[model samples]
Target: MTASAEPTPDDVVSAAKALHALTAIPDHSPRWSNTAEPTQWTATHTIEHISDALLFYSGQVARRADAKLPVLRDGRDAPVSEHLDNVLSSAHVLAALLRDLAEERAFHPSGSADAPGWAGMAVTEILVHGTDAARALGVGLILPENVCARTVSRVFPWIDLTLARPPELLLAITGRFSIDGVHSDPDWWWQSAPLVEWDGLPRRRDVKPGWT
Candidate 1:
């Protein structure tokens, strides 16, 4: 968290590349038995999920000018190398798209108000999910507190950032913890998209409908 403000498009792309490099390291040989933190997915499965998520995010930005979001598919049955490559490629493409259309407003199910906000969500995904994969691999990776803080400020503005460290705060707002007797569950949602009359309010999509 070394950044001072919302991360630029370039920062998002750079962080994603760094994450890919971390997950691409060859020494995590025994992670086959390790389960990712707070999830049933294994280390390998988590990495693949990260890549698949990047594609999903990419589709969100790619269709910024369209009324509907593109349907993205899972990265199933793919090897580690292939997953890493897809993540790297998708990150770059999404970053470039955001940079080029920085001012464009998009309709995201997550409710992003602008193109850059969607990019912020992508950055959050990299830092948070990257940590998930790394922890499962028994490694430590710290995203800059500033970047993490900026993401919280942008997407989850209702979160009380002063109450915890950047990483902990990020996890807390994302429903990774139950603070002060408040339980995290499907009702807990991030402010991914912007508010609109038709949308009612910005909320996480239902898991029953392929939200995972």
Candidate 2:
């Protein structure tokens, strides 16, 4: 992954819009197929997960805007529907924050295990989770080249590539890879041992509970 291009506020907004549009698809279609926990999710549940992520991030942005250090409560195991609403609401908050502070420095509270800065983190989640939702719904949503390029670039620094995973696989773990055909099996793990010795490569690992 490259780390040169950084998305402008417009890029972030565009990505969010694309995600919302993709999630608008009807829930009962046969096209939707991927699921993090296949036995637990349907098309509706996938959208809900996206919504949940959006909500969580948006709240963080809001707290930041208020000059308060934002802390994300544990919602990893929350139901997909609850998380879906969160994702939607959070996307709106994130977009608003981008618009309000275009040049704000990136922030990652102490416990954030995901992306580091605000823009990078937002782009990562929107791009990756959006892809997950789209894949589950069997909808084809294309992220803007610039957004993906920027994300692919920035993602390298925060990740540990030694896990011996492909760029897409790493992105899938971080929730940035949005293209189709990526698997969501929770049991499959991509170990980072092989990629550890590669020069200049970021460290990454694939654990249980695939895309959610």
Candidate 3:
């Protein structure tokens, strides 16, 4: 998990828009189905997966902030443009919900999270999967570095930022492979819970709960 400043809805909103512009270019649009290296999912599949995740998270946080809501899972065969639309739409809704009540905890399999934790997860999905989609499309995903840095600090407090920057860490977060100078630990897992709750460990997913 990347850890920093609680990711604002604005940070994710901006990154999704940037990805939209990058993929909208004629040269990149045609490669939507191409393989995104280091991951088997196609560009379209990766984006669709991100959309599903954001929508799922939004529902969780919204429920925590107010009423009970069921999450929606859209079909994957939709056009690439519609997929991007869903990504942006989900980001907007999640961001808005988090704007005022970022501190509220929501249910998560990994751990319950407040607004910052949710927002950090949202941005990480947008930027990291954005990297996957962009790589498959033959373009680079450029978002706010400061925002990414803040995100890394907040969600991945266990990492020493000096070893690598947020960009590399984002890609390696999945522990698929190394990029630039960063590598993933298959044992590594996201710290979906609040940073203040971290125990200064790597949050290894391989470890069972209640294990000291």
Candidate 4:
């Protein structure tokens, strides 16, 4: 099934509310380590990243039926508190937007040559990044079974699992690890490989990259 048959605006709002509740819990773990340069985002950093991303996408939804939103910059150098605040504020904006758009027009991330919507992108973000943030907090995220299945089906073909990496890891990289094997892969090698390099691994070309 296509994204048009997926969740509605009210559904997105409900999902966002559930995610907000998940992020509200206290995370006592040491902030994420910036070991991975460039995207040196730790667990908390990932949470902030997702929050920021949601805001960016949601803003586009609000500005116009087709507004090109700005990409997120590396905020690693920013003060931790400031970053955290930005994340929280962004998340709030996202949640509010979702609520406001209940059952409105459907968003399509893969925009027409001109404007793109955030529907599919939002679901992928909430499921994957939401799981990442929960993992950092030592909590387990129980996503809706249908959502998981749909996301997996949509993201599965886009990934190259045969590139010296576990199918699960590849799925995670492409945001499809909703079923089993999400955390089963001890080493996340797919994350280390260049996206282009994995083109020869497996899967068909019709499969689109879930995230850019």
Rank order (by lDDT, best first) = 3, 1, 2, 4
lDDT of 4 by residue, 81-192 (tens): 4554554555456545655654343233433211112333455556566566555555566655444333333334244333323323433554445434343232222211
TM-score of each: 0.77, 0.54, 0.82, 0.50
Tell how far residue 33 is off in model 1, in angstroms.
4.8
Candidate 4 Cα outliers beyond 4 Å, as residue runs: 1-4, 20-28, 31-40, 65-67, 71-109, 113-117, 149-212
Candidate 1 per-residue lDDT over residues 6-63, each given as its tens digit: 5567767765775754555564477744787777777777667766666776676677
Best by TM-score: 3
As for candidate 4, its clashing pairs are 32-42
lDDT of 2 at 21: 59
Cα RMSDs of all predictions?
3.9, 8.1, 4.9, 9.0
lDDT of each: 0.64, 0.49, 0.71, 0.45
After superposition, the stretches of candidate 3 with alpha carbons farther than 4 Å from their true spots are 1-4, 25-30, 65-70, 176-183, 206-212
Give candidate 1's TM-score: 0.77
TM-score order of candidates, best first?
Answer: 3, 1, 2, 4
Range of the 10 consecutive residues with the lowest summed lDDT in candidate 4: 186-195
Query: Residue 125: error of model 3 in Å?
Result: 0.8
Error at 144, model 2, angstroms? 1.6
